[model samples]
Each structure stands twice: as structure tokens, then as C-alpha cells.
Target: MVEGEGVTARQASFGGRGARLLLRWCAVSCWLVVPIPAVVLFTTDVPWWAGVPIQALVLLLILPIGIALWFDADQHREDTGRLLRAGRPAVAEVVELELVDPGDGSADTAVLRLRISGDDVPPFEATYRGSADPEFRPGALLHATVDPADNLFVLRNLHRS
Candidate 1:
């Protein structure tokens, strides 16, 4: 619980960092693998009539997956941006922190658990990931922007003064 501009926020389960990574990987793999069968069929001695249909069949199977993955990624960004722009000012307290190990194992991802305050809303818990100030430890008070339409969605703009 935090004392500041009182705002309504609810706990919502949005996709975390792992889900985003999986989506990106699926999109990229679809694109990379789709061309392989086409290239192999085209280079073979198969006639144009036989090769064309096979190539089209291969593309027909994989193109939709690629397109859907891209669309999902785009939609996620649009939704998050819309929520952030219309968010109301609020305050939250850091409850926990989880460090995510990167795929290349270069650096760790910083994830924070926060408890948001609202009059009728329960003690809402939300997680944020990205770079944060060193002072943002557990029990620290932080400013946040919560979506009025959906209290479960929030954006913590910690850099703002």
C-alpha cells in the first residue's frame, strides 16, 4: 500500500517476458524455415508444373503461422501503448524481485512485484521487467500509471521526476 494520488487498479495476468521471447522466436523460425523447402524444390530437376504446386503447398502451410505471429507481436505493442497513454497516476510498493537469466547468458532481466492501491480494489499485484534504479529495492515506494479502464494493466515510469 502506498500514499499518493489515489487511483483504482486491479490485478491482471498479462504475458511476461518469457511469452514475448517465445512469440518472437516462433515468428523468426517460421520465416527462416519457410524458404528452405521452396529453394530445394526449385533447384531440383522437377518440372515447372510439379515444382510450382509443391512450392505453393509448402508456402500455404507455413505463411499463415508467420503472419499470425507478426500480428500478435504488433497487437501486443499496440495494446500496451494504448494502456500506457491513458493510464492514471498511482503509487505502488515493491514486494519482490526476480532475476531472469538471458538466453545468451549475458545479463539478467530485472522483474519486480508491486502492490497497487485502490479504494474498492484489492491489494493488486503486478510485475514489471526492465532496467530500474538501484534504489528500487523491496519495500521501496514507486510511482506508477494504471489503466482506468482495466486496473490490472499498469505502466511504471520510474524515470519521471
Candidate 2:
């Protein structure tokens, strides 16, 4: 095998469309995190004023942070895609997939470990962090864009189905 033999896959949890949906869900869910606490405090007579500050913090700070984090994560993935595109490596196959449990909130997304090999290339593993639906199973064919400049970038995105 070649010295730089590996595979890369696109990280697809929340693409542009998915990100929009996440934002909307976050907006709707944000109320539950703060409002519920405030209401309970007020009703239970545990100093409703104390809950006001907490609610303010959640609305003014937590919500914004969550939204920003979500966007940042999506942007990072896009940047990776661009990097792969710029590198321009040959396509590879996702020969194997091993999913590691992600302890994050996005349980729907799976963590993928790929096995790749090519002639004149040394086999290697590339771990891709992305969320695919639970329905995505092993041995699913995925197209990868490789970075010729850096063969280590065996995994990249052109398209996947």
C-alpha cells in the first residue's frame, strides 16, 4: 500500500437545512429551560425574584451561547469541506464503518470510523465526526474527496447518499 492511504467522509449531521431546523428547535426549547424553572419558583414561593435573574440569564446569555455554538460547529464542518476541496485528492470508498457512541445531545448523529485502503498506499483509519440518521448502516457507500497535497486527507466530501 502507498504511504498515504486512507478515506474521508463528509460530516453530515446538520447541514444548512438541518442547522436551520436546529435553530428553530432551540428557540422553541429555550423557553422550556428557563420558563419552567421560573414558573415553578414563583408558584412554590421560593422567592420569585431570584428566579427572575436566572430566567434573564437563560434568555439573554444561555440561549445566545447555544445558538452561537451550534452555528460555529456547522461552520467548522463547512470549512473542513472547503479544505478538502482545495486539496483535491482522488476519490475513495468507505470500506468500513465503526460507530462510537457520542455522549452529546445529538444522539441521532453517529460517530463514524472508516477503514480505507488503496493500491500502493498504506492502509489507515480516518475518524470523521458527524451525525447521520440512525438509519445509516454499515457498508453504506460514500464518495470521498482526497487531498493530493496531503494524502493523509483521504476523506472528504463530494456527495453522499
Clashes of each: 1, 9
**Number of the top lDDT candidate:** 1
lDDT of 2 by residue, 5-99 (tens): 44333433323556666665675565457567677776887786787777777778767766675676566566556554453433344444555
Q: Which parts of model 1 have CA positions greater than 4 angstroms off?
A: 1-33, 44-65, 118-123, 131-135, 158-161
- TM match of model 2 to true structure: 0.43
- In candidate 2, the residue pairs with backbone N, CA or C atoms under 3 Å apart (3 or more residues apart, or in different chains) clash, namely 1-120, 1-121, 1-122, 2-120, 2-121, 2-122, 8-154, 8-155, 89-146
Weakest 10 consecutive residues, lDDT, candidate 2?
Answer: 6-15
C-alpha RMSD values across all candidates:
7.9, 6.9
Q: Give each model's whole-structure lDDT.
A: 0.66, 0.54
TM-score of every model? 0.53, 0.43
